[model samples]
Target: MGYIAPESPISDYDRDVVFFEGDLEELDFEVLQKGMELGFILEQRQTKTGDIEWVARDVRKFVAPPEKKVIPIPTSTKSKANPESPVNIYPSSYRTFLEKLSDSLKSIEKINDSGNFEDAVFSLLRLLGIHSVYQYSRDAQAGKADGFFILENLAVMYDCTLRNPFEEYKKDQIENYIHKLSNKSQLTIETRKADGGRGSKTLQIQGKSRQVWIITKGNTRELLVYDSIKVKEVAIKDLITITIEHCRELSYDAEHLSSKLVMLGD
Candidate 1:
């Protein structure tokens, strides 16, 4: 017994070889080719006992979906403010950089690159005076979240997505991140100093007093709940606003931002 290719025409059969039950004439070439392309073709065989048999072949072709064309969103332009204003707490150069960074984060096209977006968010968190920000690798394991940060007594595990609301925020993915968070009772994170020195320390998380936040460009609201764990949402715009406010006034610390997040959860 031998398998025949689906694309082989029935008319090209050897005259001496006989087909079982004269089924050759009933075979449709177009249907066979289409089925083969779709990996659904079945092979017909004849046993030594003159019995006809059909067997499925393990042949599958995976076709990737077409790439999506992302149209760049127009970034909002902020008017220039007086550099000599007393409220400007940062240097002129740093203030200009913060404004540009804010504009970049707001643009959909810029944040679409996950690596760049995560880096920007990490920088923003650091600028907001949250000293314990740890960014995970982009190719982190299944249950790992994008980044982790501490806010006073609160420990936040966050994932950033620039996609449409609820599109990339699948329930399974949220559950995975929650599982990662639940496993950690305490974490040791490394911090870098400007003098090119590195240091590590452990941060204790008080029982289940942790939060999983999805930072997105879309509307901020409660997204999902699994078991007793509630997954909350926060808009990136809110984070940018807090950063700007913190730049102008040092009082908008991580504790203040943490309170704002808790209020959003309510």
Candidate 2:
């Protein structure tokens, strides 16, 4: 696409502050056509900001994907846990562990307050260095998110839980979130690298990943993790030895889960 600047100057942060400055007139038919399918508009439009008044139009567009976007995943990927997978997360020592886990999940964008345990887990993941947002609320004011974390270049949605959990519940919950995330969306797109060596598949391309995080809650519990082209479900449990073992194999920070299930009595 091409453009005719206002002659003043457009900085990189134009989108952040300018609201709308893209000169769609410069956009070629091909680019505009592609942009439209990608959720963009090339026609002229107007808007009013707090104080800055400016006439802007052109190819600048906001791509809002459908509310229910379907996400697909590969088959080779599967949960790695066996009967011998040792777990180290338990209620006895979960408090100290969880306090630390909470500290690590600082990037969580939203937290569900109702019976939805996933929201709480989203917040916890952000503390654990996993970037995530929740999208359960459909209100216009509600932001876009359904417990997604920044994994690689893709935003992965995850079903979250911390209390009253077992492997069966987690497995079902994961599938539910997967269904929710895949309700609607454009075909898979690729995310380009800064170096541009090999472009990776993007959030728009293929399907996004939906993960399950069972916050260690209460005492010992049982769980499972299963994934395939059809559906993905993970069994979850609170047995410390089992959790630690699974963490070792899955490579997730076992220490985090252990800290979360810390119970004073357990």
Clashes within 3 Å, all models in order: 0, 63
- Which 10 residues in a row give candidate 1 its minimum summed lDDT? 12-21
**Whole-model lDDT values for every prediction:** 0.59, 0.36
TM-score of each: 0.52, 0.28
User: Positional deviation of 105 in candidate 2, in angstroms?
Assistant: 8.5
Candidate 1 residue runs with Cα over 4 Å from true position: 1-109, 139-143, 167-169, 188-202, 226-228, 250-254
lDDT of 2 at 14: 39
Report residue 214 deviation for candidate 2 (angstroms). 3.8
How high is the lDDT of residue 223 in model 1? Answer: 70
User: Per-residue CA lDDT of candidate 2, range 122-185, in tens?
Assistant: 4344443443233333233122223333443343543434434345645555555445445445
> Residue by residue across 99-195, what tens digits does model 1's lDDT show?
8866765663356786677667777778766777777643433445667787766777787766675645456778776776675678764544445
RMSD of each: 25.3, 23.9
**TM-score winner among the candidates?**
1
